[model samples]
Each structure stands twice: as C-alpha cells, then as structure tokens.
Target: MRIGIPQGLLYFKNGRLWKRNLNALGIEVVTSPETTEGILSDGIRHSVCDLCLPVKAFFGHVLALKDNVDCLFIPRVIRVEPDAFLCPKFIGLPDMVRAAIRNLPRIIDTEFNIKEKPEAVFWQEVRRELKGDRKMLLRGEAEAISTNEILRCAQNDRKRRNDKIEKDHRLQKFSEHKLTVGIAGRPYLVLDNYLNKGVVRYMNRLGVSVVYQTPEKNYIIETMSMLPKWIYWSMGKEVVSSVRRMLEDESIDGIILIANAGCGPDSFMTELIDGTLPVHKKPYMSLSIDEHLSDAGLQTRIEAFVDMIERKFKYN
Candidate 1:
C-alpha cells in the first residue's frame, strides 16, 4: 500500500522519522510535490474560511495524492513536545480533509507526544495500522527513535558550529545593500511562502535582507530568560525563543512575527511582545496568516507594519 506524505507543516520535523519507520515496515510511501502555485490554488479553492494558509496548503497536498496513494499519512500531531500542543487546526486536520475530499482516503492516525518516552504512541499506532510483524515493528521503532536522537545531536552540533556562518554574515558588511529585516517566527510561518505572501520576495523587493531565526545558543538563552515562566507551550516556545534571540542580535534591525489566526498561544505572546518590545531593539510586528486571501484589511496591515519598521530603522 502506498502512503502519501505532505511536504507542508510538520513535514520537516517528521520527514526522516516517518520515511525510515515506514520503509522498515515494508510499506511504500508517496509524498506531495514541493510547494507551488498550483498547490496553493488547490488549497485556496478547497479550504474553509477559518483555516490558516498552511492548513490549506496541507489540503492541497492531500488532494494531490487523492487517487495515487492507498492511504495518506495525515497525523494528528497535537503534542510533539510534551504539553505544548500543535496548532488546534492541526488537531482537526483529518476531519477537514475528510470533508474536502469526495472519497475519504484511509489515513494512518498517530498521536505524537514527546513527553511519553519518545514515540511510544507512534510505534503502537503504527504497528497496528501498518500490520507489521513483531520483529519488524520492534526494529523499526528502535531505529526510528535512534534516528531522531542522532538528528537532535546533529542539530545541537550545527548550533555550536554556527559561529562561522554568523562571522561570514557579519564580515559581509552590508552597509551598501538594502535593509536587513529579520523574520523570526515558528518554522511553519517562516518556511511557508503562500501563507506569508511570499515573504522572501516581498522583503527582497523592498530592499531588505531577511534573517532566518531558528534556535541556537543565543536563541535558547534569550528565550529562557525573556519568555514568561508559564508560557510552556511548545510552538509558543519556538516563536518566543527565536524572537528573544532576534531581539538580542544587533544585526537584526527589525523583527516580523507571522502566525495563524486563532492561534491562542500566539495571540497571548504577540500581546506580550508588543507590550514589552519598547525596551528591546524594539522593531517588531505581528501578522496573522489565514486562508482567506481577499481581506484587503490584512494587506493594509502588512504593508503598514512593514512600512512602519522601514521608516523607523531606515536611517539607522
């Protein structure tokens, strides 16, 4: 049986684990194509009004593999990192896809809670759903867990070795170039092009260098210190952690936060950020990303936010 994996949303975090696990279980997997306009169009056409752009893109991926694959791997990844749940929309994604598609494709349901000893629910669910033998399933589980640990270590190493990347960027001495604006947000927002109105292009057109803010030493330190003790949500941590680091770095002139509408934790943190930003480097704006593209008000907000930052720091 063929399984379809979407390249949107949690694809980056789970790609390696899913591929390795399923392959070991002797199941063939198929993935939706890279993000493109056609996929965006498909998503826009089928998605609900309240759905976010990334959720829409997710539907686009599922729609793309409608007939070709036997079952789709649309996981209900509510909590990948302990008590920190994924976006609520992600929790209901399976139901959304079922409604959007004419023929509800078989979906392999798995709940990933990192707090529960590393992919335990995942292996249990996968073993039952995929119908793998005892030995095969056990081996796949061990291998998959090991792969994640190795990846985590490598990510840690990359953070340690990132001095070179930082030094090179610093040495460039971009005095003569366009403004360098840092877009610091969750991976879903930063990586998603359609959701954020092609932020890279938008920033480049405005003569701005977009800085990527993923977690590192500076990011973690700033997050642990700045974010409130009660903001224990995982995705919230991702955003706050990066934003803290971005604020500390002098190289990042301004910061942009792109989040989904109805994101509870984001709304709270955005308020916290806006209220507290006056003390830090203090150039920051938050934009809510949704599937509805016809909202002119949203466009105005984005334009105004960008323009505000540009005007404030243009001469600096």
Candidate 2:
C-alpha cells in the first residue's frame, strides 16, 4: 500500500526507522515536499491563528496528502527515549489532523516502548498490530526492529558528526565577522524547515551568525537532569540549559526563540529567558509563528528584531 508521511515534526528525527520498518513490510511511503512559501501560505489560509507554525505546517502537509496516498503515518510520541519529553501536541497530532482533513486514510499506530532494551516493548506491540500469524509476527518483529535500530544509530552518529563539522565551518568563517544571533527552540522547530519557516536562512540574510542548540544535544540533555526536582518536565531542563549556554557564549549577542502558540514547555521557558538574559549580556527575542506567512508581517517582525540586535551590539 502507498503510505503518506508528513515530513514535519517527528518525521525529521524518526524517518529512518519508519522507512526501514515500513519497507520491510513491503509498504511504499510518500512524503510531503519540503517547506516553502506555498505550503506556509496554504497553512495560513487553512489554520487558525492560535496554532503554532509547526502544527500549522503539519496541517498543510496533511492537506497536501489528503487525496494523494492510501495512509498517513502520524505517530504519537507517548514518549521517545523513556524520560525525554515531547511536546503534548505530538501525542495528539494524529487525532487532530484526522479531524481537520476532509479525507482520511488508514493509519499505523506504533505504541512501542523504546527504553526497555532495544525497542523490545515497541516491536512486540507493532507485531501484534501487523496482522500476521503468531510465528510470523514474532520473526518479523525481531528482525525488523533490530535492523531498524542499527541503522538509526549509525545515521544519528552521522548527523551529530556533520553538525560538528558545520559548527566548525561556521566558527572558522565568522570568528572575526562579528555579527551574532542566538537561536533557542525545540530541535524540531529549529532544524526542520517544514516546521520553522526557514528562520536559519532569514538569520543569514540579517548578516548574523547562528548560535543554536543543535550542536549541544548531549550536553543539553545531561544538564536538563540538573533542574530542580519540583520541575519534573524534561523539556524545561533542556531549554534552560540551551539558553544558559547561549548566554554564556561571548560570540552570541542575542537569542531568538521561535515558539509554537500552544507549546506549554517553550512558552514557559522562553519567557524566563526574555526576562533575564539581557542582564547576563545576552539579549533575546521570540517570534511565535503559526499560520501567518504574510511576508509583510514576518518581514516587519524580523526587521524589528534585527534592529534590536544591531542597536544592542553597537551600544552595549
């Protein structure tokens, strides 16, 4: 069967595993095109203003595939990697998109447990759902998951390495170039184009170097564990550390957080950052994007933020 997968959200982080597992079962997948003005425009036309850019972009991808494929794979992240938190929107995106779309297709629900040794719980659940004889399901589950894990590990390693290289390249070129901008957001929002509206390129246009959280995944996750015990939220720890590191980096003059309108985690942490980072010699700003892709609005906000950065860097 031809399965449709939206290329935003968790797809960026989990595509390799999904592709391998689906292909093992002889299913073909169709993916939405990368994010562009057209998709953002459609999102603006179709989405309510209160939604965030990533969710709206998600809505656009669903609309794009409404008639184009047999099934749409929207996986609910009950949780990824056990204790690491995903935004609550992730848990309900499938149901939300299902309600919004006029047309619907079959969906593959993967409620797997990954923290319990090599995805044992997840594959057991997957095989149970796949409709095969007892023996066949067992064999398929064991083989498909093991293969998927190896591939995912290798690919993640490559990504981390490439991120390091990119960081090195940027530092070499911009060490003396002087302009700097701090970027704070969820990894998905900051790195995925279909989600963040190409803010990286826009930052480049403003003659700024990006200080992002991508290069510090392990460090961020590690430091997240250090947050006070009362704050049980996993994301808060990570965002706090990410912004703290950015503020301490002398090369970063300002920070920008692109937040989702309803994302509870970012909404709380970014406010703390906006209030306090300036005192630490790092100024910050946030632009929440949902469906409003009107160039006039985006450009104006960006221009104002850029002006703030310029003024601060020059005077302070």
Candidate 3:
C-alpha cells in the first residue's frame, strides 16, 4: 500500500526516519511537493485565516496529494522530549487536514508521546494500520532506531564544527571576508527554502555562512539541565536552547530569528531572546512570515541585515 506524507511541519523534523522505516516495511511512501507559491495559495484558501503559516503550508501539501495516494500518514506527534509537548496545531493537524481538504485517502493518524511510549509501541501502532507480519514490524523498529542514531551522529558532527569555529578567535574578527551567522527558529522554516525565501542561500550569496538552530541534541539536553525552569514546548525550547548555546560562540557574528506570524509560543520566545540578546558584540534580527508575506520584502530585510553585520564586523 502507498502512503502519502505532507512535506511540512514535523515532517521536516522526522521525514528521514519515517521514510526509512516505511521503506523497510515494504510500504511505498510518497511525499507532497515542496512548498511553493501555488501550494501556499491553495493552503491559504483551504485553511482558516488564523492558522500559522507552516500549518497552512501543511494543508497545501496534503491537498496536493489528495488525489494521488491511497492513504495519508499524518502522525499526531504529541511529545518527543520529557515534560514537553508540540504546539496545539501539531497535535490537531490531522483533524485540521481532514476538515480543510475533501476526499483524501485513508489517513494513518497514529498518536505518539515518545516520552510516555517506547519505539516498539509506536511501530505497533503503525502495524495495526498495515496488519503486516510481526517480523517486518520488528525489523522496521530496529531500522528506525538505527536511523535515529545516524541522525544523532550528524548532529554531533555539527557540534564539532561549531567547536572548531569557537577555538579560532581570528575567525570572529569582522575584517575576515567570511562570516558565520546563526539562524534560529522552527526547523520547518529554517529547512524550507521556499518558506524562508532562500534566506540561507541569500546569506551564502552575501559571503556569509549560515549555521542553523539545530545543535547536537545532547547539547540541548545539557543546556536544559542548566535552566531553572523546564520549557513545556519542545520546538520553542530547542530553538531557544540553541540560541543560548550559540550566543557564547565568538565565531558566530550575528543571529537572525525566523518565526511564523501569529505563533504565540514563537512570539514569546522571540521576544525573550530579543530582550535578552547576549551582552557581547552581536547583532540580532527577527523575521516573521505569514500567508501574505512577500519575498521581495524578505530579501530586502536580509540584505539590510547582512550589510549591518558586514559593517559592524569589518576589521577595524
């Protein structure tokens, strides 16, 4: 059987694992096309005016696949880390898709609170949908675990790169032609070139290297341990924790915060980061995207930000 996955939101976070596991189970999986102007418009037409841009974009992806696949796999990812949960939109995403789009294929809406359930149990939930052999399910579970470890190793490699940058104080000198700027926000926005209007590429065009909000997962755990209060929202905490860690790196010259318009949790976190930007000599900017956002405007903002960083960091 074929399963359709929307290429937005949590999919950006877990798509690799999902694709690897389903393929292992001998199930064909199809993904919606990347977010684009046409997709965004379709999503906006189908969704309520108040939903965040990423959620609306997700609607578009599902709608695009409505006629093409046998079933849609919209997992209700409730909790991944301990004592934290995803935004309400994520928990209610499948329902939103069902209400917004018409005549979609069977939806495999499995709920998972990873903090409360084991990996085996989550696969078992999928097994109920497939009714596949138990041996296949077990094999898929093992493959899923291996996939996760591989992703963790990649994150560690990123940490090592960051550490190298930190040790080279000369790299922090603004006079250097190449500069590294840390971009922090939801993975959906950071990872989606269309959604972000190619901000990462634009940065590269400006001779600036971009570092994402994704730190080694273990580093987030370490940073969280130092906090006096536990963050209840997983994504928000992850971004903030990454920012907190990145702020200390001398090699990171500036920060650009990308957020979806009308995202309450993101708004709070952005403001918190804005108000308490590190005392060091780093500039910060926040860009928010909505259904009506224009790429021209976003590009202008990015250009201005890059210019500011360039001037400030220029070797004296």
- Using TM-score, give the best candidate's number: 3
Query: Candidate 3 residues 1-316, lDDT tens each?
Result: 6778899997766676677566655678899988998898899899999988888888999989879877888988898766789998888988988888888888888887878886557766775676543434544444444434544544554445444432231222333347788888897877787887778777777888777645667877776676666568988788887787678888788888888787989988887666554624577788887755557888899899888878875854
Give the Å shift of residue 261 in candidate 2.
2.7
Q: Give the per-residue lDDT digits (tens) of candidate 1, residues 1-316.
A: 6778887777654565666566655667788886777887787688776666677787888888878977888777677666566767777778778888778568876765667656644665665776543333434444444445545544554445433333332322333446666666656556665566676556665666677645764455555565456366666766776777677777777777877664666778787666654535566777777555565665576567668777776776
Q: Would you list the clashing residue pairs of candidate 3?
A: 174-313, 175-315
Best by lDDT: 3
Q: What TM-score does candidate 2 get on C-alpha atoms?
A: 0.73
Candidate 3 stretches with Cα past 4 Å from truth are 132-177, 225-228, 277-280
How much is the lDDT of residue 130 in candidate 1?
62
Give model 3's TM-score versus the native structure.
Answer: 0.83
Worst 10 residues of 2 by lDDT: 168-177
Candidate 2 lDDT, 69-147, residue by residue in tens = 7667776666555666566667677777766666576666665434544454454455445444333443444454554
Candidate 2 collision pairs: 52-290, 53-289, 53-290, 112-122, 113-122
In model 1, the Cα lDDT at residue 230 comes to: 38
Q: Which segments of candidate 2 are over 4 A away from where they belong? A: 20-26, 37-50, 112-120, 127-178, 192-198, 215-218, 225-236, 274-279, 295-301, 304-316
RMSD in Å for candidate 2, one decimal? 5.0
Ranking by lDDT: 3, 1, 2
lDDT of each: 0.65, 0.63, 0.75
